[model samples]
Target: NSFGSCSRGCTTIDKLHWWGASIGNAGCEELSTQLVSASKPYDGKPARMVKNLLLGGNMVGDACMGALARAAAKGALKDVGALGLSRNSIGDAGVKALAEALAADVLHPGDLYISGNRFGSTGALALASALSESAAMRRLERLSLADNRIGDEGAVTLADCFATGGARQLESLHLHNNNIGDEGVVAIAQVLSRTAMASMTTTADTKKSEKGIFRTTFETIGTLERLFLCTEGAAEKPQEDLPPAELLPPLYCLRTLNVGSNRASTRAKGALAGMAAQRSVECSV
Candidate 1:
C-alpha cells in the first residue's frame, strides 16, 4: 500500500485499539522506515540533528511509541538539542524506552521538555533517575517538566538527581505545575547552592570577596529566563513556604522566578526576593 493509505489504515486500526491490526497494515518494514525517518529527519546531511524533536499530543500508545524512540536512538540521531514528548499515552514501557533514549550518548547537550503525558509521580521519578544516571543528561542545558502529575515524591527524586554532580551542566530547569511544594523547592535550592559553589571555586581564588559576590562563581542556578507557575485566575494563592537560611544557603544564580497557582504566601515571596536582591535574581509571584 501507499504511504498515505498505510498510515490511514494504521490510524483506523489504532483507533480500535487493535494494535496488531495497525502493525499489520503498516507492515514492519514500512513502519520501521517511517519511524526511523521521523526520528532522524536529517541523517545524511552535514547539519546535526541536535535542534528539536517535538512529538507531543500524538496519543501514541502501547509499544509503538517506545519502539520508535528506541529506533531513533539506535539510528544515531545526533544533536537532538530539544525534545518534547508530551500528552502521549506513555506507560511504563514507553517511559523506560524514552528514558533510555534520552540517556543515550546519541542525544546530548540539548534541552528536554516533557509534560502532559500519562507519566504519574512514579513514572516521572523513574525517568528523572534514569536521566540522572546518563552521561548524556549531564550535558543538558535546560529541562522542562510542566503540567504532569509528578507529585512531591517525583519532585524530590528529580531534585536529588539535579543536585548531584551530573546536573552541574544544567543552566535552566522548569518544574512548573508539578506537585513540588516548599519542601521540594527547598531541596532543589540546597543542591543549586552546592553546585554553584563547585563551579565557582578555583585554585587561584583563595581570597574571599569583600562584597561576598564571587565573580568567578558560575551561580549554578541563579534565575530562569522564563517560569510559568500561574494558571490564569489562580495567581494569588501561595502554595508553600521555604525554610530559613540556617537550614539552607541562598541560591545566588536565580534571575527570573514564577510562583503562581499555589499557596505561596507573601512571606515566602519576600524571602525569595531577599535572596534574589543580592544577585539581582528576579522574583515572580
Candidate 2:
C-alpha cells in the first residue's frame, strides 16, 4: 500500500518511532507528508491513531521541523499525546515553529521531550510563553529540555511564567544540564514561593466560605465522649459566597524539578531548598 493510505493496517499505527534513523531533512519531509495525509479521518473511521511521535537523533533541521509543526498546528495530529524530539539539529527557528503550534492548540500532549537540541534562549522564551499562555498546555504533565543552551534569561523567564499562573498541572520539569546560573535559580525559587503562598491563601479563603459542609462535632457524656456527625444544609447548593475555583490560580503541582549540572551556586541551592521546603517540592540542584 502507498504511504498515507488508510489501507493495510496504516490506520492502526498508534506510535511513530523514528529516533536515530539518520533520516535527513528530505526524508523527514517525505515521512511528514505521509503522516499528515494519513492523519485525516475517513469513512467514519478514526484518523491515524498515532499518539506518540519520536524523532530524536534523526538529523532533523529547521526546514522539516517547521513543516511538521505547521502540519500539526493545522490539526493534522490532533490525537498525538506525546512528542519526543531530543538530540536533533533543530535551531531557534524550528523550536519557535513548534512553540507556535503548541500555543495554537495543535495537540494536547501530556509529555514533551526536546532535550539535546541546538536551540538557545530565544527558543526557550517562545516555549515558556506557550506553556504559560496556552489553555491547552494545562494538561501537560511532564516536560524535559535538558542538554540545551537555554541560559539565565530562559530560566528567569520560566519563573515569570509560573508567576503569571501557568503550568498548574505540571508534575515534573527536567531542566538539567542547561546554562542556568545562580540568579536564575533564585528567581525561579522566589516566584514559586510566592505562587505557593497565594495558593495557600486561596485554599484558606475557600474553606472559610464553605458554610454548609458536613462536620463532626464532639459531645461530652457523663462517662465518655461521643462523636456526632451533622450537616445543616450540606445537600443544598453552595451559597453565592462560594468563590469560583477556576477564577483563582491553582496551586503549583510540580512534584519534581531537575536543575542539576547547571551554574547555580551554593547560596542559590540553599534558597531553592528553602522554597522547596515551603512548597514541598522535590528539587535536584
User: Best candidate per TM-score, number?
Assistant: 2
- Per-residue CA lDDT of model 2 for 1-285, tens digit only, reads 001223221224776767688888898788778777778878898777577777778898888778888778657767666777888888889889888888888865777888998888899899889887687776676788899988899888777777675665566788899889997889888876774665443222323324565422212111111011011221122434322323433325666788899989989978887887776778888
Residue 34's lDDT within candidate 2 is 77
- Best-fitting candidate, measured by lDDT? 2
Q: What TM-score against the true fold does each predicted structure earn?
A: 0.59, 0.77
- Candidate 1: tens digits of C-alpha lDDT, residues 1-285: 101122212333111112223232124335535545544437575422323444455555546545656556666345445555555566656666667666665555355656555566677766777766775554455566666666667766776765544443444555566655665555555554453454343222223356653322222222231122211111122212211112222222234444334343455445544543444445443
Can you list the residue pairs that collide in candidate 2?
none
Cα-based lDDT for every prediction: 0.48, 0.70
Worst 10 residues of 1 by lDDT: 225-234
What lDDT score is found at residue 114 in candidate 1? 63
